[model samples]
Target: MKTLYDVQQLLKKFGIYVYVGKRIWDIEVMALELDHLYKAKIISNKEFVSAKLVLTHEHKIEELKIKKLNNGGGL
Candidate 1:
């Protein structure tokens, strides 16, 4: 997937919807679910790798945001 929305749509195709109140947590949960799907051979390696790239990018962004906020860098 290219964006977080694409990853979410991919999960939705399998009847999975994740909303953990926080974006970072939601992304983390989605990653776990994606792993399960891959392990079950429900998703191909390409899909798994693409989804992971998106999730990892999004997760890093979220972490940076959190860190900046904690450091009083205020957006």
Candidate 2:
């Protein structure tokens, strides 16, 4: 997927929805679910890798946002 939203949409297509009251946690859950789907052959390696990349990128961004906030910087 090109973006986190795209990854979320892909997961939704598989009837997977995850929310843990935190964006980073949600992304991590999505990544784990994607891993399961990949292992089950429900998604191709390319699709899994793409979605994982998006999720990783989003997770990093969220972490940076949190760090910024903790450092007294506004997002």
Give model 2's TM-score versus the native structure: 0.90
Q: For candidate 1, write residues 24-73 as lDDT tens digits.
A: 99999999999999999999999999999999999999999999989978
Which residue pairs does candidate 1 place in steric collision? none
Question: Could you tell me how far off, in angstroms, the CA of residue 1 lies in candidate 2 after the best superposition?
Answer: 1.7
lDDT of candidate 1 at residue 65, scale 0 to 100: 92
CA error at residue 4 for candidate 1, angstroms: 0.4
Model 1, position 42: C-alpha lDDT score: 99
lDDT of model 1 at position 32 = 100
User: TM-scores of all models?
Assistant: 0.96, 0.90
Highest TM-score against the true fold, candidate: 1
Q: How close to the true structure is residue 33 of candidate 2, measured as C-alpha lDDT? A: 96
